[model samples]
Target: MRFSQILRFHLSNNKWTAKQQYVPKHNPVLEEDIKRLQDFLMSKSNIVVLTGAGISTESGIPDYRSEGVGLYARTNHKPIQHMEFVRFANVRQRYWARNFVGWPSFSATEPNHTHHAVARFEREGRIQSVVTQNVDRLHTKAGSKNVIELHGSGYVVKCLSCEYRIDRHEFQDILNSLNPEFRDAPDMIRPDGDVEIPADYVANFRIPPCPECNGHLKPEIVFFGDNVPKSRVEQIAKMIYNSDGLLVLGSSLLVFSGYRMVLQTKDLNLPVAIVNIGETRADHLADLKLSAKCGDVLPKLFNFKK
Candidate 1:
């Protein structure tokens, strides 16, 4: 079913849901959790924060591995691998098609309470910097000062064969122009700005080339199985070394890239705090672990955003 002129697809009932809007619920245990987290924060300064999918789940973006409501749990769709995305024409075509459909809703997502809390904490001189595995770019939007996009952001598209780059907004317009018939089609949006289109209709999806040299254009995010850029890795390593401790928020730490951050902190004998609802790879190593909703716990613990 369509919503006005725009095509809308909802995953739950395989019907249509409302236009995207998100507001976090208040937690009953927030007060006690805040006090505990505050006490934990008191012992650390100049800390490094590592965040993941769990952080954005409250912002209406689904995560990949949450037990009841994650992408991996519900579907067989795998995130595109870097090599496949680069090597195959059909892969790029499909990716861009899904991205084009999902962009409006995904990019329209707002910063949630935990995002603002982290920004406030940074402003108040609590943490040194943020290193995130997410490609959403919501941290900077929430007013975080020092942020390292460990996996890059989905806001820019770059050519694989050239340095030609363009804002995703510009690319959206380009996509609409090239594929007018599909500019608004039935789309089921996902967390990473990819949508679910019918398998048969995908054959007709159009993909635009880089205006400069007709090179392949891909989002700036480091796709799974891709190595993080050397410079980005080096920078994060420096940030980790210059920190007082490590604070992990809303990550399952299943990915080695994110899990390694805490391991380095452990090697340095620094205190590590993990705030997540689910079990993490580093649970045994955490100096403090709080299983709570990030949106509910963070705003209460750090209200400097106002």
Candidate 2:
């Protein structure tokens, strides 16, 4: 695919789906396949690892599309829409209620073996950079120096109408002060740090406005019905252009934001390797596809201590 074709494809498929199911299955991988993955990394000088929610699942965060234990598999909960979050007061109230209830546990999650091994890969100069769809910031927490958060970070809260910015922790404190009596425990934390709480518990929940401008506040993330910023896309494109290959870690590439990076690599005739638990959208396009957990396989490849 050419640049024009890539752009067209992105435009066509950028819409969000309510639910996508993948069988919770891991295929047997041979020793020779492991060797092939090692050789694949050895053959590339500049490699970019594109990661997704699967990488953080081991850290105890649930992704939306992973097989049985994923959020969609266990619940019929729908993600908050970009427009609704921006336009509706009630939606923002419910969202903040869930976030407030779930933030403590979600923020406490630590980086797992996969994150540490990827950081090791960067330290050893085997990989040049990481482009992750995960907003959890685990890659950076694991000591990866050059990381691009393709979908943005949930740890940041920005004013929708102005230049006010606040750390999520600070915002959490504000939420605590405002809703002192709204103590509700979440059933479970979703991938986006949201949880399921009673509707009545959310009715009186208060969400603060931007202190600097009284503007609407939202997390700095690309929501389900939103597009990734054009500048961010161009930045990743430049990284891929300078790289020898793309190594997808833990991502199924169901979302085009990450999948398009694989497509762009393919268009450049670069080798693409996938290390994931199950099937991926780009399995047919990969030079080698390893159906294994990232935490399990990455430690073996990098010889990192768990």
Candidate 3:
């Protein structure tokens, strides 16, 4: 059954199931598609896996733009822009306050089967490397060693004025000690571990400065209004150039950073396969496209038991 005009094909009866617990709806069409994907992977020697927020959604994080369940569909909350965080003190205060509340759960999230399957592919020499648009370190947690976090990582915090860096866990402790009175529950958690809290909490929150250099502290992430570091782009381009094929998982590819990889793969005349729940920006370029969740398709693709 199609959902509106978007042509979403569900592989399960439920669209929103817990991570690693996806039950196939037993659609024969989906089964055939899975077989095709398996054959496609078997034919390739070195495959590059590109991932985005959909992979993490099964782990209970809400992304920015899904049909009905995304953060934008659910709320009008906008993420902190890069210039806003740099130019305004209040923006940093709000960002840190929300991040402080959401950090515990976000940090504690475990890797799902999709991540494990990708790691398994690497172990078996079926894939060359991974390029991920997610800030969450689930890919690394799942044992994908050659992951390129194209958007940087939320597990790290760095000073803008210097090379000073600290593990995000360590910074959390500093936040705890400085803001003892500003405690509240979060309404929701974004993909990057940010949440919605009271405006007053943001106003009263104390953002800690870098102890080493008195510089501004920010998560090691490429914010919406910021560009991905050029060196990182070159790294991904090189990876794609060396790989034989591209496997896109769970990403809509709306962001140019992720989408351009697909474009590059096509320009190189390499085949591309996409497994996502909705229409992606690079669908026309894909040699094969399956409208299904990553948790459902990845296990079958890797021959992992459901």
Model 3 over residues 63-180: C-alpha lDDT tens digits?
8887666767667768779999999999898888878887887798778889998998898899999999999999999999999999999999999899999999999999988988
Better of 1 and 3 by lDDT: 3
Clashes of each: 0, 0, 0
Q: In angstroms, how far off is 17's CA in candidate 3? A: 5.4
Model 3 scores a C-alpha lDDT of: 0.83
Write one digit per residue (lDDT tens) for candidate 1, span 159-245.
989999999999899888877778446435543333678776577777787889999889999999898898988888888888988
The lDDT-based order of candidates, best leading, equals 3, 2, 1
- Worst ten in a row by lDDT for model 2: 15-24
Give the poorly placed runs of model 1, Cα more than 4 Å off.
1-32, 186-194, 302-306
Against the true structure, candidate 1 has what lDDT? 0.79
Best-matching candidate per lDDT: 3
Kindly provide the TM-score of model 1 when superposed on the true structure, using C-alpha atoms. Answer: 0.88
- lDDT of each structure? 0.79, 0.82, 0.83
Model 3 spans > 4 angstroms off: 1-29, 183-194
